[model samples]
Target chain A: MPGTADEGFYELRLYVAGQTPKSVAAFANLKRICEEHLEGRYQIEIIDLLERPQLAKGDEIIAIPTLVRRLPEPIKKIIGDLSNTEKVLVGLQLKPHH
Target chain B: MQEKDDIQQEITSSMRNYSDIDPAPLEKAPTGIDGFDDITRGGLPRGRPTLVCGSAGCGKTLFGMEFLARGAAEFDEPGVFVAFEETPDELIRNAASVGFDLAALSAQGKLAIEHIYLERSEIEETGEYDLEALFIRLGYAVDQVGAKRIVLDTLEALFAALPNEFILRAELRRLFRWLKQRGLTAVITGERGAGTLTRHGLEEYVSDCVILLDVRMAEQVATRRLRIVKYRGSSHGSNEYPFLIDRGFTVLPITSVGLEHEASDERISTGIAQLDAMLEGKGLYRGSSVLLSGTAGSGKSSIAAHFAQASCARGERCLYFAFEESQQQILRNMRSIGVDLAACLEGGLLAFHNARPTQLGLEMHLALMYKTIRTFRPRMVIVDPISNFMSLGTQIEVRAMFTRLVDYLKTEGITAVFTSLTSGSAIDNLERTETEISSIIDAWLLLRDIETDGERNRAMYILKSRGMAHSNQIREFVLSERGIDLIEVYTGPEGVLTGSARLAREAQTREAQLDRTAQLELTRVRLEHKRHAIEAQVAALHAELAAEAAAFDTALKAEQGRDARFSEDRDRMATQRKKGPFAARQGKGE
Candidate 1:
C-alpha cells in the first residue's frame, strides 16, 4: 500500500517437471494473472525439474506446476494450475478491480 | 511417471486381497542356508517383504546378497537386487568372495543387479513426488530377469536422500505393498538405529517379517547372531542363533530336546580284566554313557585309554576328545601305561580331537563336535576328563550342551565314556562333576586316593551301574607298566591295607607260625628220650632175673653129682642133705 505504481516489479517463479500439460497450463494461467494484476510491472521465471531438479527443494515444492512469489515481504506458494483468477489474485495479494 | 502410475493402478486393482489385516498362512521360499531352513521350517515368507536391520558391518548387505544369489543358484528362482549404497560392479566383486558369480547369473538372465543412486544433494523431492523412477526401474529389472525374489540393499540410503519424513514413510509403506502386489519375496536392509530397529524406523512399514542381525564381541572374538523379531503366521526359532559366514552362511540351533534314543543291551569289555570282572564279567552296555570320576593321578585317563585300546582292538572305531592334553601328549602318556594307541591311530581306527576349552564358544564347541561326529562316525567316544569343559561356560549352559551331545551320541548308538576329575579325597561329592549330566550316565566308576599309613593308595569302586550287578568292594587300583591293575584289598577293622602295610601283616603271621612249630618239635624230642630210658630199665631187670635162675640151677646140679659118687653111702647123705635143706626151708618159712 505504501509503494507507488512504479516502485517495484513483481517476482515470481513457476516450477514444473518437463513439458507436462498441467505445467504448461499453470504457466499460462500464472502469466495471465501477472499481466492482469500488475500490468507492466512484473517479471516471471520458469523452472523445469527435468533439467534443473535441484531448484525444487529451494522453494520447498512438493507437487508439479507450483508457483512461488519472491517479493516485497513474506514469500508464498500456490500449487496446481492457476485457473482460478480470484484465488490467484488474492494468493498474490492483489486487490480486485471495482 | 505415467508408466509407473499405470503399473501402480494395475497392481492396486489386482492386490486388493493382500490386506494388512489378513491372517492366512503365507507361502514360503527356502533361503537355502543350512540349519536356517530347519529353524524357519522353510525360508522367508513368499510374496512379502522382510526387513533385515543391523549396525554397520553386521552383515546386512551380505545377507541380502547371499539370499538373492542362493535363490538364483540353488532354488532356481531368479532374483533382482536393487542396491542403493553399492554399485553393480562393487557388488559383483564383493559377492564373489561368497562364491556368487553374479556376472554369470546375470548373463544367464536369471539375476539382475540395479544400483539406485540416492545422493541427498542431487535428489530433490519437489511437488507431488513418488519413487516412480525406482518403481519403474525395479519393475523393469524384475521383468527383465523374471525374478521371483528382490532385495533393496540398505533402504537407509533412500531415507538419507529424501528430505521429507512424511513422504518417505508414505512411500515406504506403498513400496512394501507394491512388492507384495508383485508377488515377489523381497528383503530390505536398513542400518540399525540408536534405540529402534532402523535409522528411519522403517520397521513399522515392513509388515510380514522382521529379522535382526547382531555382531557381538565376547572374549575378544566377534560372533554374529541372527534372530527373528517377528513373523506373521509361522513358528520360527525364537532364540538368537549363532551364525557363521564362511563360504556360506550357517546357522546352528544349539540344543534340541527328545529322550527317544534307543538303548542297546549288548555289553562290551573295558579292556582291563579286573574292570570287566567288576562289571558283571562283560563290561559296559553298548550305546551307554559311562563316567569315570577320580581325583588327580588316580588313573582315570589310564582307564579311559585302556577302554579306547580295547575298542580299537575289537575292530571298532574310537574317538577321543582331549581337552587338557595334546594328541601327542595323550598318546605318549598312554604308551607308558601299556595302552599303545599308536596302532589304532595308524590303522585309522582311532582319532584324537584335541582343543582348548577357550578356543571358541560352548555352542561352537558343540557344533564342532556334531560336525566331527558326522564326518568320523566313530562307534566309541571317549571324552577324557569332561570336567575341563567347565571353563567354557556356566554350569547350566554346560549341562544343556552335554545333554544335547549325550542324547545325540545315544541316538547314534555310539558308546561314550567320560572322565571327570574330582577334588579332594572324598569321591562321593559328585557335584564337582560341574554339570548335572551324571543322572544320564549308565555307569559311574569312582576312584579315590585312600591315605593310610603315610601313603596314598588308589582305590576304585563302582558307584552305579544302571542295568547290571557291579562290584561294590573298593579295589586297590595301581597303574603299572602292564596296565591298570585293580587288586582285591584286604579290609581289616582298621581299614583297607595296600602296598607295605599288607606285606607287613602277611610277614607277621608267617613268623608267629614258625615259632610255634619249633616249640612243638622240642617237646616231642624229650618225650621220645624218656620212653627209651624206661624201656631199657625193664629189659635189664628181665636179664638179671634170668641170670639168677641159671646160677640157682648150677648150684643144684653140683650137689646132685656129689651125692651120686657116694651113692651107696651118699644117697642117705644126699637124702639127708635134701631133707635138711627142706627142713631149713620149712624153718625159714615158719
Candidate 2:
C-alpha cells in the first residue's frame, strides 16, 4: 500500500526481472531515497516482471532493473542498476536540483 | 533444449539476412582512442559488454586499460577495473612504461582497480550457488566510485574456476546481462587458443561486441592488428586495422574511404623569391602538401628548412621532424645556411622532433607523429627525408603509413612539406623510393646533381604542380655562405650544366664567350666613332663655302647699283666717281 501523491508529486514503479543482486540493490537504493527525500508524498509499485511476463509489456521492460514512473503527468523510464544514485535521481525527476 | 535450438535457428537465419541489411542503430560510447572510433563508427555500443580477445602478449590488457583510461581522461567518466590475472600494482606498473598514469587517475577518484584473487583448486562447488557475492562486490565498487566504464581482465580465469562448461556458459551469460543491466560499458578480455576465438568459446555467445587483437610476424617483422569480429547492432569496419602500443595505445584505421572536403587555396612562400616566382606567382598553396625528392647532399633539407623558416617568420608554428639528424646536428646544419632553428625554438615558433626510423615500427612511428601533431597543433610540419622510414618497414608498409599521414594532414588543413631521398644516377627509378606519393602531392620538386665533364653542379626543377604553372627550366643551385642560391643555367655543348662537371664546363664556356664578345663589341664601337668624326669635318667645310658665296653675291649687287647711279651722274661730271668708290669700299668691307 502507498499514499497518494500531491498534485505535482510523482508515482514511481520499479520493475525488476528477478531477485538478482542488481535488483536488490536498485530496490534498496530507491527505498532509501524515497524515505530521505520524497517521504510520504510518493507511491512506489515494485513489480517482479519475471513472475508475470505479461506485465513486462505493460511497462515496456526490455531489460532487468528498470524503473518506470507511472503516476507522474508524463511517464519516465530509466534502465540500469541503481549504483549511480545521482544519475538515477536525475533520471527519475526525484531531485529538485541536480 | 528446444528453445536453444530455436535460438540457434533464429541466429543462422539472421546471419543470412544480416549480410545484406543495414545493422540496427547502436548507442555508442566514445572510446577516445585515436582513429579507433572512426573504424567502429563512433564507439562500442554503450552499456553493452564488449569482449576483447587476443593471443598471449598481443596487448589485450593494454587495450583494456587504455579503454578505461580514455574513458576517464576524455569523457570524464569514472571506470572500474577487475583483474584476475595481474595485481593492481603490476597492472599499474606495466601501464606506466607506456605513459599511462593509472595510479594518478585512480587517486583522482576517476578509476578504481580491484584485484580478484581466485584459487581454482580451493573452490568447491556444491549445489547451484548464485554468483551474488561477486556481483555485490562489483556493484559496491562501481557505486563507491560512480563508474561508467568497467574492465574484467581475462574472463577465462572465471571459467577455469568452474569445472562445468554448462555452468560456465550460464554464468558468463548472467555476467554479461548483469553488466548491461548496470548500464556499464564493460570490456572483458579473454585469452585466445588454437582454432578458437576464446578459451571456452563463451565470448562469442556472451558478448554484444567482439574485438580481436592479433600479433603475427610477417617477413620477420612483427605487426599488431585489431579487428571487430562482430558488433551486435552496429556496422563496424571489417578490415584488420593496424595499431601500436608505444607512448600510448593508438589505433590506425587503414581502410577508410571518401575524402570530399575541399582543400585550402592560399599559397605559402618557400622563402625563395625566385623559386616562389617560378611557382606561378608565389609558392605552395596554404594547407597543401609539398614533396621534395632528391639524392643525398642535394639540399633537400635546405629546401624543407626554407619552407619552415618562411612559416615561422610569418608568426606561424612549424614542426620539423628530422629522422636522420639529432636536434643539435639539425640546429648546427640549419645555422650554416642562415636558418636559425635554435632562435625559432627559443621563441617557441619552431619545434624539432628527431627520432631514428629504425627505433620503432612503422605504426609506432606514425602513432608518435600523430600524437606530436595533435599536441603541438602546428600550422606547418616538415619530415626531413621520409625515405629513411624504408629501413624500418617494407615498401608497402612505408607507403601505407605515408598515405595515412598525408590524409591526416590534409584533413587537419595543415600545410606539410616532406623530403624524400632519391637515387643520384636514375631519374626514372626515383619514383620507386617514394612509390605513388607524387600523385597525391600538390607540388613535387626534383633536385639532382647533374654530372658532366668533371663538374658536379646541383640543379632543381619542378616536376609537377597541381593547380598552377611552374618553371620548366632547370635552375642551377649553389650552396654558399649565404644559403642555397638558384643561379642561371649555362647551356654548353654537353648539356645543361650540373654538379662539378657542369660547373667547370660552365665556367670555361662562360670565360670563352665573354672574351670573344668583348673583342668584337670593342672593334665595332671604335670604327663607328671614327666614321662620325670624318662626317662632322666635311659638313663644317661645306657650310663655310656656302656662307662665302652668299656674301660675294650681295656685294656684287650693291656695286652694280652704285655703278648705275654713278653712270647716270656722269653727265654731272666726275661726282659719280665718289659714289662708285664708296660702293667699291662697301663691297670690299662685305
Candidate 3:
C-alpha cells in the first residue's frame, strides 16, 4: 500500500535508460539521501524506460535521468544526473524543511 | 563505394547490437519552464539529440545554451557543453551576459564545458579515424561528475573537418546513437545553408527533432524567426514565429496565435487635439498600429513628432526610426512644431535610430530594429517614412518585411506609428509599396496637400480606424511655429483645397458669393420691411377716413332732421298762427 500523506512519507521513481555513468551516479546519490533521511518510510521505484519504451508515456517522459515523485498529491519531476542532491531533493518535494 | 558500404554495414550492425541491449527509461526531467515542455511534447525526447539550425546570428547557439543552463541551474541536472566554435572562457563570458552562471554551475561539479578546437587546414584524416576521440572525451567529461544535458555548439565545423561526406554522415549517425545510448538529452546547433535546411544535410535526418531559425529582411527591416521543421513522434508549432534575443539570452516568440491573453484597452492621447478629434475622441488605443500616409511636406513628420512627444510626455519610452533625415535635422525641424525632441532625448525617454534606407539589407535593418526594441523596451515606436525601404528592395520584399514588422509589433502589444509617403494627388490611394502594407494596419490617417486656385492647403482625414468611430470630414491643418493645428473642414468649394493659390482663389470666390448673397438678401429684406410699414400706415389712414365719413353722415342727417323739424314748426306756426306761438313754445320747452 502507498504511504499516507499524514505519515510524512514519500514514494520516488528515478527513471534511467541504462547503466550510463550519469545514471549510475543518480542512483547512488538518491540511495544515499533516502537512506540518510527517508529511512524505511519511503519506497524508491526504479523504472528502466529504455527496456520498455512504452512505459515512458506512463509518466510522460522525454529525457533520461529524471526523478518522479509519485506518492505526493502534486507529482513533482526533476531531470538530469542527480549530482546535486540538494536540488534533486527540493525538486522532488522531499526537502526536510517541508 | 565498396569500402563505404562496408563501413555503413559495420555501423548499422553496431547500432543494432547497442539497441538490442537498450537500457531502462530514466526519471522524467522537468525543465521547470512553462509552455516549453508542451512544445517539445514532453521535454526533448529523453536522452535524444535535438538539432537547432539557423543562419548566423539567428539565436541557434543561444537556444542550446539556454537549455543547458536551465537544466543545470533549474533542474540541478549537470550539463556538458562541447563547443566547436567559441572557447570555454568566451562561452562562459557570453553566457554570463545572458544571466547564465556557467562558472558557478561548473564549480558545483554539476556542469562541464569543453572547447574542441579543430582546424580544417591542419587536420589529416586517416582511414582508421573515427569520432572515437570525441566520444572518449565526451564520455570522460560526462562520467567525471556526471552530466545529464550535453550541448554541441555546432556540428558543422566537425563535419567540415572530416573531408569525406560518407564518413561524416556515418559518424553523425553514430554520435546521435551514442548520445541516446548514454542517456543524455543533447542540444546540437547547426548552420543553415542557402538552399538546404542545414549546412550538413545529415543533421536533419539523424536528429529526433529539428528547429530552424531564419534571419531575414522584409522591406529594410530584419526579423529573426523560429520554426519547428520536424519533431519526430510529437506535435509542435509549425508556423515561423518572430523572436527577439534580449537580456538573459531570452528568446521571445512573437506571433504565437491562439493564446487567449487579454490586451489592455487604455487609450493614449496623440497630443494634437484636432488629430485626437479626428481619431474619434482623444487619441489612439494603446497597442494599436497607426499608418500615417501623406505626400511630401504634408506634415507627416510633424504629426509623427507630435505622437512621439505625447508618448514621451506621458513618461512612456519612445523609439523613433528615421530613415530619411539625420537625428539632428529631425530635432531641428521638429522644434518648429513646438516639439523639443532634444529634451526628450536628453531625458532618456526617447531614442532616435537614424540610418539610410540602403545602409543595410532589409533583414539587417529589421534585426537592428529588433535589437533596439529589445534593448529599449519602448512603449511607443515611430518609423518616419517607412516607404523609404522600398528603395532598397522590390515591392514584394518590402511588403513581406512590413508584414513581419507589423505582426511583431502587434504581438508585443506596443503602440506603433509609421509614416508612408504617397503622391500628393493620390491622397487616399496608397503608394505601390504602402498599398501592400495597408491591410495589416489597425488605423490609417491620410494627409493631403490640397492645391486649389494656386493655394496649397494641408488637410488630414482618417480613412479607416478599426474598432473606433472616427471623424469622416477632412480637417484643415496648418503648420505654424507653435505646432500643427487642425481646424474645421473648409466647405468653400466642391474641389479639395490643396495648394495656397487654389485655397485663396476658392476663399475669394466663396467670400465674393457670400457677400453678394448677403447684400442682395439685405436689400430685399429691407425693402420688404418698408413695404410692410407703408401698408400698415395706409390701413390706418383708410380706417380714419371711414370713421370721419360716418360722423359726417350722422351730422348731415341730424341737420336735415332739425331743418325738417324747423320747417314743420314754421308751417305749424303759420297754420296755427293763433296756436303757433304756444306749439313753438312747447317744442322749445321740450
TM-score of each: 0.68, 0.71, 0.59
Report the C-alpha displacement of residue B86, candidate 2, in angstroms. Answer: 1.1
TM-score of 2: 0.71
Clashing pairs in 1: A61-B127, A62-B127, A62-B128, A63-B127, A63-B128
Model 1 scores a C-alpha lDDT of: 0.78
**In candidate 2, residue B340 scores what lDDT?**
78
Distance from true position, residue B430, model 2, in Å? 1.4
Candidate of highest DockQ: 1
- lDDT string, candidate 3, B30-126, tens digits: 5433334545445676677777877788887777777888888888788898888898899889888877888998898878887776655433222
Candidate 3 C-alpha error for residue B296, in Å: 1.4
Candidate 3 TM-score, true structure as reference: 0.59
DockQ (CA atoms), all models = 0.05, 0.01, 0.01
Off by over 4 Å in 2: A1-98, B1-25, B124-128, B256-259, B390-398, B433-435, B492-494, B498-590
Best by the TM-score measure: 2
Looking at model 1, give its docking quality level: incorrect
